[model samples]
Target: MIGNIFLFIFATGALILLNKFLAAWLPKRNPKEKYLSKAETLVFIIFLLIIAVTIESYDVNSSVSVFTIGIMVPRQGKTHRTLIQRLSYPIHEFVLPVYFGYMGFRFSITALTKRYYIGLVIIVILALAGKLIGVICACMYLKIPKKYWLFLPTILSVKGHVGVLLLDANYSKKKWWTTTIHDMMLASLVVTTLVSGVLASFLLKAREKDFAPQKTCLESHDTHEELRVLSCVYGVRHARGTISLISALSGCHGASKPFAALLMHLVPLPKKRKSSELLYHELGDDVHGDDEFGTNDGLEINDSIDSFAKDSKLLIQQVKLVTKMLNMHVEICNATEDLRISIVFLPFHKHQRIDGKTTNDGEIFRQMNRNVLRHAPCSVGIFVDRNITGFQQPHGFDSVQHVAALFFGGPDDREALALCRWLANNTLIHLTIIHFVSEDSQTESPVRNTTTQDNNDVFIEVAGRDQTEHEADRSFLEEFHNRFVTTGQVGFMEKRVSDGPHTLTILREIGEMYSLFVVGKSRGDSPMTVRMKDWEECPELGTVGDFLASSLDVNASVLVVQRQRHSHDNFLDD
Candidate 1:
């Protein structure tokens, strides 16, 4: 009996050592290959098992002999580890239920007598107390997050499959484990497992939103302050294009209060992991890339970003997070609040192909974008790329990059113009301000804040303006024109449109002329976009953004800007 007990302890030590050794091999996998097949994983486990069986004493279970091998594998890069976790998740789901069910079937709960029940109660109390004390000690020893302390004890106390497998393996061989003893062990196992699961569920649910409060928004933000932007992205396909947009935003006329961004590249998380061993996110690296199925261009995405940052005046913090896709928005919102972000830049749900045809990437991604829009604490911009991964400069007398802001007079429009104010700082960037107004519009100072009355960029004088409603619009637009246009750094123009169709026509005609087009996500009750909603496909993009993003042949990319609107909504619950 003493030898048997010693073997159990000895085998456990071996398991730990092997797991550590094997875990170190994780980095050997491709950095871009974030997934592993169940078949492949199973073979790896089997290989470890065989090696462990060869090394360990026959008295200990083979599972126990190779245990440390599970923990000792090669250390993986953040992306590699995250990939395996996500890839191995479904296999865990399938195997866990099957394993647990088989164990449950071996138990005979109804056969226990009053005497056995009394003993069972004692066993359970001892088990709970022992695990709880051990966990409390570990918590004090290791600086684990205090929040996880609420559930880790119970989670660790939950009975595992290995013990049951051992009991069954030596069912008739062990003289100590009589039928009566076996029944009681299985019964106690079920009790502890059920209790642990319930407690963990309750605890985790309560702790889900323990994140800090989010209060910043772009509307009230200071223009002179360095913009703290939380830009969320997925995959490496659009990384360069996203960086290009960030480059444009980094320039300012003065000492340049450029954006200091926390660029988050999100990936799906694994289902199960050791709380102490897991890292939810880590700083992304500047790796190289190639176009292969398992090894894709994702590796090179950060290299481009690194190169860009090295040469540019922008401050960028790259982070990669591994989390559930459904609950990703919660993480984004938390990061926004933690970093006090002023704005969040999101990619459009639909991506434009080389042929100018647009296709919806994924409904899940779209839902995540909506959730972010609903819960984000700051201003948001949905960037729609139309072959603008490289925002090609027009070859002309200008021979420079042209940026256009289509203003329809609203809080969002004002924000778009505010961004344009910074774009004007880049002498290579020629800024054009296009105001879409109705026939009943008036301006006291229409003495042309604009220059070079060219075709399409003409100033139109109108009549019968709404003084009360357009008060803010007129004030902001006039200020923008006076400051930028009067400095001879910007071109200002006004176009009178009868309806949404006419406005859209005018926009499409001049869309490709500029390298980038900026527009407000809302039309601000303007009659110009009243009917545009009838054809609006992506409401998250707003009417104008939807028009440009969904169009089959618009070469210029669009940035749909939305200023934060104050409302009494829950952080994420509402």
Candidate 2:
């Protein structure tokens, strides 16, 4: 009996460490990997079924005693044991406690009237106090968020299993001292578990009220620079990923159709060649071919042979060149290193038509799955002028005010900077360009803010504290003062550095507050297509985009911009 008691006590201590490890491991598993095999599931279900039937059989004492025997069921093999171990936790954490607590509540007062009473009270108090101290230690170590503190005590409060185990000992013991100790311990376990559960639940609710809110700053000002906007510039491989406010106003008009058409228009087409008579421009001249093709090198390329075999590679290269000539941002990369190519391409296949033309939305969305979803960047968004959804356009501010511009080095970021430039130079909108510098960049691309004399309005924040950190990584935070907190010119333009949750988080937080969430369309489908493709490479965004899309809390209006290609009268007609 003494050995059995000692073993149970040691086992409970081991369970504490095991439970902590399980808690950390469970949250990280992929959904498919989180569960046990079908065979294990079946075994657990069968055990649970038997336990349920036994508990309801009205033989309460025997039913409770059977738990020990039940856990010792014949293991089919190591795999079966592993599965049983995985499945046991759910029953141990939830099912077993409730039954034990209820059973404890039914303890007889008459049976406790003898020598067992004092020992039971003492055990109960010690168990409860020990659990409380453990919980407090956990709280301190975890820095448990105030809103969640009430929940902490409940996690520690469970004492029913120990109480049930004590019951078996009480029955086996014949001596007064041994029986009394068993009864007292059993009683204490019951009282401590119940009291702990209630107190923990209440405290958790209290902590939740004090939960710290995430903080971000947003600012906006009146500007006269007309918002240069484009929607769904890049091609989206999958049209289904888009969520356009325009889609909402359109009254459930399939988002994919318009979204696909919007993307095709965004794909930068190859530049067209004009007849030889056009005047030469100094910029973008073909320096490499000047000696081979004479003065009018472009004029000698009319032969059938040149057109037939036509080094398909050269044509493609020329097409790419022309596309860049059209001012489309084109980046050539080693396709082998990054097997995934993330581009905001037309979401609809070329065959589908929209607006009296074919559309590509359906084909892209339906075919998308985990393997291909990350292989190619696939998010789609449609931009329409008239509210497809009931979104109202913002009216220009006639009162004239201040503006702040965020400087990040992407298309949308540059556009935001351009908007600020336009506002500062051309309109009533007072503009300040705020660039966040990291400690590493401070020594390299250091913006001598000393150039500005306007101390009241102009501001720059260096987000990084240490000098050794990567310049690209640092975010600027104003350390001592909320200088721009009340300033009217202070504005925040949401800039997505890469495809990730931070973009969504920044978008949701600043989306409604800013006059616009300045985002650059792929110039290539929907704004999200390029963004999502970029996200595929990032571990954080790939995990979070699905959840954020379903969340009710996010708020923001997306403004996508496509850079206009510079064209002249000499351009090809097609």
Candidate 3:
């Protein structure tokens, strides 16, 4: 029976991996990803029907066996498959918590009166210590940012359900005071969860208060969404936590500020920045560079700055919507070394778009940054306020194993690789660099027509060129492999050149195979264009990056490194 159960577990695990692979790799006929493909959906439905049939045919114990087997059946497609995604969450969240709580319930009060008391105390200490150790090791091992190192551990430490499940699976058959042990374990689990969650809440609240002043000069006032948005743009974890805290605080009805702080403790920090460069270009400008920032020659304007400013102004002009909202004065400025603008945020600002001619606050900021980047004769860093790290330990990866970096012989790309090198060590991430050469159009060439319609076919048609591209990819693989040979990484390297119409699109399509995107922050007069090769169209700033972040959708983030951190005393830095 035990062997059968083990077999069942293995089969179910394999099927789950297969399902995930198909979900990620299959081409989507519908671009929106609104519903699972028709064929997959049908298979999923059949899977459900088989489970239902098996349940009807078997008794409770037999049904358990059947259900275990049913999990192994392929269910690749189904309508609203993501809707089913929520179910696993409950198993992870609520059921798992209950499982752990039940384990705590297994402990006996009488055990404390016996020789077991000292051992139990040691056990409890060891458990907590183990989790903390894991967190610390992850941080030091991954070299995570100082701020993230705080909260990452607390959130990672909440092992309620899964831990309980594992304990039960392993100890269910034990007869040595088994029932008592189970109850005590269950009860302790409950206590641990409540206590840990509370601790997390308080830590986050304190961190927010600390960072609020640093985020923007608006320490005197309470307008924070703009700052939150900016942090989101930076892909900093602290920024994400601040946004959650601000959103939660703003929506709370009767909670005292202290209580609000307590609740803020439990939230996880943001993993990635908002990632839409276009929005910053658009809305950030409007807020900072209104008529106050005069545009000189060759200065491009963004739309977000104006949007943020205008929206903020409107919130103030129409105070009824946010009468209960806190109004603080936060100072905002572009830290670009070139043309720039700075603005003081008041509680209320107007947000109006009139025939494409309406002016607002964020738009002003966007325009100001653009003016600076184009003609300021220097770089810019927009500083809003200053706040920093949470109190909990950060969650870090085991070892930076298997890292991949994208390089295009540009400074930004080189800078990105340099950053990776700084982060690398023996036990850290294994790095792979891909440098692809795109074919330039042959000028005034006599064309030969071919019947092949597929793009992959075109690449194959060029025999010598195909060999050249493959050799380039292989050479990269050999170089990295040789470099890491002594580090117990038997091998490390992979590369490919995509002659696709859009670099960003190709990046997105194939990016999921890697852990993170390490592309350069494109700027200046570099020949590296954001233009989609297929259409010869320049996408808005941050378009490809944002879409890629959204599509990958799971534990993936993009890092946009500033060549140098711009000096700006206005925004917060903590």
For each of the candidates, give the backbone clash count.
Answer: 28, 39, 121
For model 3, the superposed segments whose C-alpha errors exceed 4 Å read 1-6, 21-33, 37-117, 144-155, 170-172, 194-574
For lDDT, candidate 2 versus 3, the one ahead is 3
Candidate ranking (lDDT, best to worst) = 1, 3, 2
Task: For residues 73-137, write the lDDT of model 3, one tens digit per residue.
Answer: 33323222333543468766887678556655655676544665555566666766777788878
Q: What is the TM-score of candidate 1?
A: 0.56
After the best TM-score superposition of candidate 1, give how far the Cα of residue 313 lies from its true spot, in angstroms: 5.2
TM-score of 3: 0.33
Which 10 residues in a row give candidate 2 its minimum summed lDDT? 312-321
Q: Go through the candidates in order and give each one's C-alpha lDDT.
A: 0.67, 0.34, 0.37
Q: Tens digits of per-residue lDDT for model 1 on 1-574?
A: 5876576567566655655444434424643444344554565557665655554445445554444444445333332344355546765788777877876777777778888999998887787788888898899797655776767888876756665665555446678878788889878777877888888778867775653323354434455666777677776656666776776666632345646867787765546643544343431232222122213444465545645654664446767766787889888877777787777888877776676567888898889888887777777788886654326423233657788898777778878787677677666678888887675544454434534655544444333435653576667777777777888889877777777788888878886677788888876556677688888888988888888776644677888888765332468456
Q: Which number leads on lDDT? A: 1
Question: What's the C-alpha lDDT at position 309 in model 2?
Answer: 17
lDDT of 1: 0.67
Which scores greater on lDDT, model 1 or model 2? 1
